[model samples]
Target: MATVSMSVNGKLVSRDIDPRTLLVDFLREHLRLTGTHVGCDTTQCGCCTVHVDGKAMKSCTLLAIGLEGAQITTIEGLAKGQELHPMQAAFREHHGLQCGFCTPGMIMAAVDMVNRKGNHLDDQTIREELEGNICRCTGYHNIVKAIHSGAEAMGAAK
Candidate 1:
């Protein structure tokens, strides 16, 4: 076991965990932040995506022990009080989710994309960028729309 210290969702946390524990497991099992899903243990699935130091990362691909002192943000951290984040609101408004299993990761990835790409994300670019995030339902039509609108909203918010 190794001692790991990190900031999660604006809260400072330190824990003793197995050296090989994945970030997703650390978040879900240790911190009880189950919002970060584990759709696939492999990095191919984006269901385990989260923001680490303002950048999107596959939590399953990183070991918790290797991320000491890093700042992580899960889907649960995106909202403030009762208000939803712009990307989340856009997804809800556009009906971007169907089964909802991938919603959290999708939202996190979209937020990070918009944050990096700014508000000019076109449909083609959005679709291309979201290739990593697979949604078995919805065919990604509404997801693209939501990202478009969400990108605009995010820019406006800033």
Candidate 2:
């Protein structure tokens, strides 16, 4: 086992974890942050997406021990008490989710997309950017709308 330390959702966490443990497991199993889902352990689904040092990354693709001292943000970190983050609020308002299995990761990925692409994302750009995240229920129409609105909201906040 190897000792790993990192800042998760603004909280400092340290644990003795197996060297082979994936970051998604570390968050869900160790920290009890189940918001980060694991749709595909192979990193194709993007359900294990999280913010690593403010950048979106697939948690299942990263090793827990390789992320010592990293600043991570799960979907649980996006809200402030009862208030939701802009991306989350947009997802809710736009009805972007159906079964909700991919909502958490989609919201997290949207936030990162807005951060990079700014608020002026066109529909085509939104679709292209979200190719990595797969949502089987929604057909991605509402998801695109949500990202556009969320990106605008984030820009307004800034």
With a 3 Å backbone cut-off (N, CA, C), the pairs that clash in candidate 1 are none
lDDT per residue, candidate 2, 1-158, as tens digits?
98999999999999999999999999999999998999978988889999999999999999999999999999999999999998899999999999999888898889998888888899999889888899999999999999999999989987
Clash counts per candidate, in order, are: 0, 0
Candidate 2: stretches off by over 4 Å:
none
Q: What residue runs in model 1 are displaced by over 4 Å at the alpha carbon?
A: none
Model 1 agreement with the true structure over 91-154: per-residue lDDT tens digits: 9999999999999989999998887888979999998889789899999999999999999998
lDDT score at residue 81, model 1, on the 0-100 scale:
86
